[model samples]
Target: WKSLIRVVVSGAAGMISNHLLFKLASGEVFGPDQPIALRLLGSERSYQALEGVAMELEDSLYPLLREVSIGVNPYDVFEDAEWALLVGAKPRGPGMERAALLDINGQIFAEQGKALNAVASRSVKVMVVGNPCNTNALICLKNAPNIPAKNFHALTRLDENRAKCQLALKAGVFYDKVSNVTIWGNHSTTQVPDFVNAKINGVPVKKVITDTKWLEQEFTERVQKRGGVLIQKWGRSSAASTAVSIVDGIRSLITPTPEGDWFSSGVYTNGNPYGIAEDIVFSMPCRSKGDGDYELVKDVVIDDFLRERLKKTEAELIAEKRCVAHLTGE
Candidate 1:
């Protein structure tokens, strides 16, 4: 068995983490043979709830869970952390402006970044799950100058999974039949779910579905706005499915990609071949070799339609970065 892997989770008392913590304790993410120590980070308002969460973990009696720690300070909980899941952020209230929300969450990530830089493992893998995540991730990596920019990621796996499900349902196939459904650019409604490159049962999606109009219009809109649609139906943002996507996101990094398959993730865009702006976290197709290292999937054919969509989403991300520029030290 491998040694204990230390994980730090921010927003540990929230809905997403509420579902995610138990999965981590059960060794679903890092494998059952690998023991894990979880450090849960929360704010003062959520400390008591965090303790309740710890009590639940104890009751679960997971064999691979070696230790659990809860605290309000990131510095105290993040020490030597190997995996940091940043799932906490200020949600936009009824009257809150988008820029105001960005500034508030940007401050939170900036502090957490400094704390992680000071105490966490030099090679710690950071996944930003907070809202405006791509920009928040950029702010985080900028603050933690010592950590490699490639080590930071923003969650876009949920969007990828959503796109796949849409394709599968339209084609009357299992979800697993869809491949290469990359989410380009931001995680917001501006996100472009690239069905052009997607394949169904090893065939191009357009050829199988025979509804290029739907794929170009309704299909893209569905994936981009699925979160809001869910909230309208459920009265809350996604939690369980979001947790599953997080597992998939981490697993994709640790496991080798199939010979011709790639997964989508929001990663640093420096030197990317897609003409994306550098120094920003953007979602793109990537492949890994099971060594916790990944490279962008080059050679994706972007036609005029996909290129225009990419430019739109990229503009949104660039605008978001500008909104948090002061926090990012730009």
Candidate 2:
């Protein structure tokens, strides 16, 4: 094994983490030679399911899996953790309001924030994957002042992947051939899938495909509501793809960005490319150095269309921050 580090995964019994755990154990996020010590966190009601997951993990007998621990206590689960995948939060059900959902999860993430601040490794990196993740990341980041803001992130890489796939399909190219796709602002429907800067096999996307109608309307809406579209077609929300996106997000953090290409991630607006309000966890085109650190890619072309869309997502995040204003004490 290349290295051994403790990783705490929240919502260990949930669907996303159920797939994520295996990926982590198999060294998909890290490297094949790396061993990981996994600490699974769940709600009290999910303890039995967590145990069954642990049992299956043991049955799989992954060589890179050094050790496994399960608990419902955040304090216990977060202790000595180097990486925390905060995936557990109240999923939005039928007729549920965003404000109500945030309030419920506010308490959960607030407690976790405290536990992470109190006991986790000083360099611990936290990735928020639960719903309302951008704001939820803000809550956790606000609650942990000791850790650097850059240490916390929300998963917008899913949107980035979705945008790349959509563009690739429209361009009649493979997804791997798509690069420089950015998911700007919130991970919600207001997100901007920037095809303006996207490239398919080193050719400018716009130069290759000249359907302005498709790019302006269909591309925008499809990337924004792809999650809902999937649910309508499959009778479920995204799970496997979400899991893959999580792996891509983490890998982007731990691996250096490819030359001339960047990935998108939800990050604090401190010294960002945009002039958006500070303290909003916004997604920006980013380059990583494989050191658990990232730098925003700046000075990209932003026409009126892109600018307007960015503002809308910014406004949505601002309103979301206001809804949880009580939690942030701002």
Candidate 3:
């Protein structure tokens, strides 16, 4: 029998997890030779749904899946976890302001952070997928004083993937032909989908597309707001794509990056070359060596326009940090 890699997933009954759980169990994120023990976390109100989800996992009989446990409390579910996927949070209600949503989720992450610090593996890699994920990840890391902040990540691979797709379609090439697309700053509308550094078919995107106006305006806006566009067309938030991005995000961390290529993730901004604010979770170009470690890609050219866009997203993240100051102890 293969050794078990303990993984804790919060919001286990949500739409995103509905898709993600199967992928994890199928060894799509981790390798086929590795086995995993899933510890599922959910709210008391969602316990039955969580049970049903577990039942389905049991029915599927994935070869790489070894053990499964379900609970409503993070403290109970987080023990010895090597990977924590914080995918659940209260959604923005009809009249709820963004600040209010941050505060509510801030409390949730703060408590979970403490739980993780107390029980999870010291080297656990956490991926925060909850909305306002950049700020939520910051809050989570801040509250977990014992855990290194670098272990926490906000999901921005979706934006990076979106940017690559846009560039591919505009250049009339396949999506895989596009590379080096970096998502800078928070995971919000203000996030910068940096076409300046992206390439198509091993050539700079600007050199191929040749439409400065569309690249600067249409391409960036489309990537940044692609989530909203999907919701508008589908009448529901993106679930399957979001799940796939989570897999991609985690895979990027564990797999060695291709030479001359980098992926985007929301990482701690301290020591970052681009002068993003310290102690905040901001997305940037990153490369990994398949050892569950990554470093920020340095010396990427950030033109004046991209610099200004980065500043806007940084300011928004700073304001969000201040809004959750009480929870984060900022």
Candidate 4:
């Protein structure tokens, strides 16, 4: 048996976790050579559902899955974990204000941050997948003063992957042929998917598609709104695709992509060239080597239009940060 790696997945009983757990158990996220001990954390109210899911996972009898444990408390689940996925949050239901949603998630993440600080292993890496994930990640980072800031990342790879799929479809190229796609700013509607420097088969994407007007109109909007489109088509929110992106994000983190090729992720900005304020969590093209540090991609051309969009998205993130600060009195 391979050595066991403890993986803590918060919000273990939620819809997204339901979709993600099977892949993790089957050794799709972590390599097959590694044994996994899944540590699940959920709210007390969802403990029964988590147990049921654990029972199902047990029946699968995955060779690499050495153990599965469930807990209602974050500290218990985080104990000695090597990786922690902060997937649980206060999801918005019908007729909820943005502020209300952020407030609820901030409280949840604050508590989780303390728990992570207390019990997660010294080298634990965390990825926050909850909605408003960037700021929620910020809350966790601020509270977990013990952990390195770079070790706590938020999920923006989902948006980046969506952009790649859509771009590939439009360019009549295979998805693997596309590279250098970037998702900047927040993870919401305002998130900027930079295709300016992207390529198909190593040729600049602009050379393939000359319709600047159409590029400005359709491509950008489609990538930004793909989640809503998926919801419209499926009559529910995206789970499978989101789960796949999470896997990809983690994989990229563990196995660094080659130089000159990078993926988008929510990373800490010390007010870098992108004009993002100091320490704010925002998505940028980043390269990692599985050591938990993400270096930002710099000097890519940002046209006037792209700059405006980036500003707009950054504004949204700033507003979110302030709103959460107000609620939590931070």
Candidate 5:
């Protein structure tokens, strides 16, 4: 029998987690041979909703789902968990400033990070999916001094995926044909999609597409604003795609990255070789060794355009860190 791995997912009752929990339960993440106990954590307002979610999970009868637990307290849900999906955070509503959103979610993530530090396995790998994810991850990592900062990651595969798909469609090739698309700096709108490094079917994207205008202007803007465009069209933020990206981020951390290809993930930059300054969570190309460990893809060429965008996103994350400085205990 495969050893049971406990996975904790916060915001278990939220729209995105609703999709993620089922995927995790079915072994889409850890493999079907791996039995898993899923713990769902929510806040007081969503505790009852979490119960309903648990019931639905029970009805799903997922073969790999050895157990299911739900709670309003992170202390309970985070106990000895080996993997944590920090998915729940307050969404930015009308008139809500970015700083305000970070401040509100800061308290929640602070408590969660402490809880994880208290009870989670020393090897726990955390993937932050909540908005302002890069900084929220920084907050969580700061509070959990026991956990290696490298074990914490923020989701940026979504932007990378968007970039690849855009290139694939324009090139009339399969999505998988486009590879090595790196999303740098942040998960927010200022994210820099490094098209210069991307490849389609082993051919340089620039040669295949031949539309320097689109690559330089349209494609980057679209990838950066993809989430906002989704919200504008759906009247809500992305759920399924976001959930898929969460799974992608987690799987990437646990599965060895393929040769010659790397994925985008936001990671700590305390000693990064990338020109990004230390002491903040920054997104960059990364490769995993299938042990919940990743190495940043070093020596990536950053042109003037990519450099300016990376700097812009870095400033935003630094500002967010300042916004929640009081909560992080840093």
Candidate 6:
């Protein structure tokens, strides 16, 4: 246990929360011995449902869980928390207009951001997992002016892991053997998954595959549409892995990456590293832990082909930020 750690999970009774709570209770996400005090934040409408879930968590007798509480107010839950996982938002239901959805979530995140800035611990770390995650994260970061920009991030490790799995299957290599793969820019269909520097047994993937056209048609499309495929197959949105990716994202933030190998995360970029937009959250390679924080694993070269995809993803993120700015008057 690394002392008492306060974790506030917004949307804590939702689908992703159902999966995440057990993980946190079991200490799989954080350390096994670390005692946790969970403050769940949800809307007034969902308060009773969240309370039921919290009761179940308590009955489960999780050794590391020191306490659990459900709150309808964001300010009540945000106080003195070391970690805040922003998972709740207005999801993009079928036929919902994109602008309307963004506006709704932008409003939610903006309020939470202000609450966090006002109350959370000075060293709080935040991860926004809602749709339009990068922009939602940016809205929160911007609203929370007191928090460091570097502390806010969006979730994109799921995309990165999906890319790694696809590459491993295509290359006939163990998933562990594949290293240095990077997912650049937004967490959308336009995301750039770079294979130029990826290696299988230390051999460059580009040299081994030698099929640029195949890569363009098969690999890229598969990586981009993975979430859609899963949703179609299961007849529901992605849940378990959404929680798993949340774990992976936090682990990559606190645990050091091994030598010559790194994981991907949606993090703030300075643009020089990967030409990603400065002052905005975008998925990029990172390594970190303890008192130290995530730093971009830059120096991976981007050819013209990769550059185009990166630009497309960045454009989407930029437009999203603009939309939020317009909505919030920031």
Off by over 4 Å in 6: 289-292, 327-329
lDDT of 5 by residue, 184-293 (tens): 88888878999988899887788999999999899999898988899889999889988898888888888999998899999999888867878788888899888889
Error of 2 at 65 (Å): 0.3
lDDT computed for candidate 4? 0.86
Model 1 score (lDDT):
0.93
The runs of at least 3 residues in candidate 4 whose Cα sits more than 4 Å from the true structure, single-residue gaps closed, are 326-329
**Sort by lDDT, top down from the best:** 1, 3, 2, 5, 4, 6
* lDDT values for all models: 0.93, 0.90, 0.92, 0.86, 0.89, 0.84
The clash count for each model shown is 0, 1, 0, 0, 0, 3
Q: Which clashing pairs does model 5 show? A: none
TM-score of each: 0.99, 0.98, 0.99, 0.96, 0.98, 0.95
Top lDDT prediction, candidate number: 1
Instruction: Please report the TM-score between candidate 1 and the true structure.
Output: 0.99
RMSD of 4: 1.5
Residue 314 in model 1: shift from native, Å? 0.8
User: For residues 134-194, could you state the per-residue lDDT of candidate 3 as single tens digits?
Assistant: 9999999988889898899999998898888888888889899999999999999999999
Instruction: Compute the lDDT for candidate 2.
Output: 0.90
Model 4 C-alpha lDDT per residue in residues 1-330, reported as the tens digit of each score: 667999998888988899899999999888889899998898888889999989999999998889999998887889988899888887688899998899888889988888888988877888999988999989888888888888888899989888888778888988998999889888889999888878778888888878777677888898889888888898877888878888999898888778779988997776577776776788888888765566777867788888889889888988898888853347
lDDT of 6 by residue, 233-297 (tens): 99887999889989987877777777777777777775556656786778887777535377777
| TM-score of model number 5 | 0.98
